[model samples]
Target: MSQHLLHTPLYDLHVNMGAKMVPFAGYEMPVQYALGVKKEHLHCRDAAGLFDVSHMGQLRLRGENAAKMLEMLVPVDVIDLPVGKQRYAFFTNEVGGIEDDLMVTNFGDHLFIVVNAACKTEDIAHLQAHLLADVELEVIEDRALLALQGPKAVEVLATLNPQVREMVFMDAARIELLGQECYVSRSGYTGEDGFEISVPNSHAVALATALIEDDNVEWIGLGARDSLRLECGLCLYGHDLDKTTTPVEASLLWGISKVRRTGGDRAGGFIGADVILTQMETKAVDRKRVGLMGQTKAPVREGSPLFDANNHQVGIVTSGTFGPSITMPVAMAYITTSCSQLDTVLFAEVRGKRLPMTVTKMPFVAQRYFRGE
Candidate 1:
């Protein structure tokens, strides 16, 4: 039996543009267009690329205890997150394992959150079940999300609304685009200067069309999206993160604010605070997420066994791809802490051959996020 796949508002436009479609997160989404993945990846790095990210889930949390309630689930300093600011965080489980990684924006009256498409359902259920007392979770089902990314992103988008240029990184505003109200944020996964716009589904086509017509903008697809994010060292929800992976092991300690840790005022109050705090204090994580740079053109894919000097298996690749921007194959993996140091030598077993790989710093491509002066 075929699974019933949902279609985003821009599905027809994608087909009309000669995009190759595939099933992703229960939705029929474009994997690549006629321009191909390599071209799309280069275009985004050189100019601007428009991506249909409507498959992502958007939700609003209301009530006076909205931030307080959310603090019980994640380690971010939500209570102090100023209005109009966005923070990257993860929804952690009771044992310090990650349930889902997400973005939380304090919208003054309500909190706006964006979760991974595949984890949206469970994320909402978790919130409702745990925060039933005072917080209300309202799914924003009537909006379509679009991401405009690259070096020329700011220039192209500023032409639509000059106010967009005024906004800094991680700052959001309720702006009007092509005569429609949109919640716009200056943030993205591709490590570029970009904006993620959430517009009403009714006017999604019009907005997308307007952006596509821009000279600097090209329609991008999932293939390039994956490559772009990989080069940027961003994690894919299902592959790089799961219930068994904790933030400490994932090297995402930056997401947990100092105020939320053991010595802070509101210490260790979240679901997995105990385990997470212990790992932080003792640095006792068995495995750590590290970047693998392949010396050859062959891309080392996920699940490939990583070996040490003695050819003993130490870990496995979690996400790997040909980084078009960097023009090489790069991968992310969790390996024994002993081998997680920079410049550590390792071998990836791909096919029947062993390939030499070096542990390198992530974000193979430099990020151009527009943080204000």
Candidate 2:
């Protein structure tokens, strides 16, 4: 490991629990614990899994003009985002490319944001440059983020705060957990019923310890995190998405708010509105993001070149892993638009051999979000 690698609040605890630490996004994070990636991946789907995600960037934006200032940067409807709700958005470049994806929560007087760890520095600078004079930006480094995910997430978290049982997916609130005032959101990246807790650094260890004490909960690592998100077809910055990939081409057109579309009020005012909205209507994009399932047990990995019937290079795999839930190799790739149809058979060259991959619908397992009845 490099001497300059950073550590999260749970670094010592992770080491104590026998985590196999690795360098990820400038942090010495755990890639897997003794449970290993395969078991941890399946455990999260059946029971609950605890994940240390404190390395991700958390920010607080304050003042009355904060929403209005943020509206100019992304092509999402932020101004009317109801208080106590969280929404997914991305920073768009002038060319309609995704700068970085993030989650924004309306906290009444202020907004809470979580961005990709690798892009936090640039995200903060971008926010500072465009925000109005009255808006205040605070890079929150004093809090530690943890994600509790799986089918039993609500059952485990309810033991800490019974109120959490009533909170639905994308709901955000301040709650007391193990005597710590924490920001709690009923959301996660694994496409499961889960909760993300942002606790003060001082209480991070205690909070994590309390959660993992449950037999249903076990520590999960980055390796399983990647596979979990991949199974859900979620985009990872710098992998499935980057500065050159537009949301439209990524099959993320649904993320663009209807109010921000071509003819709606307050439309076309964002940085890349002209190009993005045009692509939405014309569908002129030459390539698209799609899910690929391998025909055999062999795995298709990132950077593997994709091909067509005539051996013509078409696209490249961005993320691939054997999803424990499905017991098969699954991958997400960007393929030429003409060959991206569902059920379209594509070929991926791995280790000098062309393997068959079929274009498949995402979320290999159905998402199990807890929405209140």
Candidate 3:
């Protein structure tokens, strides 16, 4: 076990539930409970699954210039983000390489940030160093995050706090559940209609316990979390995205708002603007990340080499797994821009053998995001 591992508020509850513990992103997390990965994945897809996501980093930025400071580090039009709405964006280096992918929710006077656990330390340092002196950066270390995901997630959550059903996807609101103030966002990584609830550490156990009491909700672990995100074609920071991959190569152009991309009134003053704007104008990205489906039963994995019909190494696999929904092995890889077209034939080097594969549209499994009616 790694000595630097941190434990979440629900760590003991997971161990008591017979979860398989593992170290992930410097945290002692449960990879799976007694039910295992496949079952947990299915449960979340077919029903509701509770996840402890406290390992993620949460920060609050406040001041008259918070939005301006954030715009300097990201490519999104933060100034235009409506209050009470959350937007997905990335932190970029000076060269346009992705430093980290994160979600920023505008709350009128302040902004709430949720970043990947692996990049928390660096993200905080970057913000503190670049933020204007007037802006206040506060790390919420005394909070815990929990996600309730699936088709029945809303049904389960509605029972606890009826107001949650009124929030639309990508929208957040402060609500009182069981007399505890919580920040509830209608978003998640599982590609399902879910809610991420942020609560004080002191009330974490009670909230989790209350949610778990619902017969429809089961405790899910990191193992299923990985499979769920994979089915949804979501990128895992360290594996799918890294300092070497730029936002353009990662197929995350949608994150850059049109106003920012075209240099609206704000103009292009953010980090990596030169390279990002150049890529946008020329569409000259070298490799593009795409989804791949294996023709055979073989399961491809990370570090797998990708080859074209000429047997030339074109790219490498970033993440892969046997998708429970598709009942086949699926993978994500970076391929030459010319060969990134859908239906392009390729091969994955699995266990010293080249397995037949083809480029496919992402989100191998359809998403079930619930937008409040």
Best by TM-score: 2
Q: Could you tally the backbone clashes for each prediction? A: 0, 0, 0
lDDT tens string, model 3, 1-373?
7768899999888888898899988899999998889999999999899999999999999999899899999989898899889999999988888999999998887899999999999999999999898999999999999999998988888888898888888999887878888888999999999999999998999899999999888999988899899989999998999887888899998988887876477766789889888898899998999999989888899999999999999999999999988899899999999999999999998788999889999999988787755
lDDT of 2: 0.94
Candidate ranking (lDDT, best to worst): 2, 1, 3
lDDT of each: 0.92, 0.94, 0.91
Which candidate, 1 or 3, has the higher lDDT?
1
Give the Å error, residue 1, model 1. 11
Which 10 residues in a row give candidate 2 its minimum summed lDDT? 262-271
Candidate with the greatest lDDT versus the true structure: 2
Task: State how far residue 90 of model 3 sits from its true place (Å).
Answer: 0.6
Native-to-model Cα distance after best TM-score fit, residue 88 in candidate 3, in Å: 0.4
lDDT of 2 by residue, 1-373 (tens): 8989999999999999999999998999999999999999999999999999999999999999899888888888899999999999999989999999999999998999999999999999999999898999999989999999999989999999999998999999999999889999999999999999999999999999999999999999999999999998788999999999999999998889998897777887888889999999999999999999999999899999999999999999999988788878999999999999999999999999999999999978788888888
Runs of candidate 2 with Cα error greater than 4 angstroms are none
Task: List model 1 lDDT by residue over 340-369, tens digit each.
Answer: 999998999998999989999987888889
Candidate 1 stretches greater than 4 Å from native = 1-3
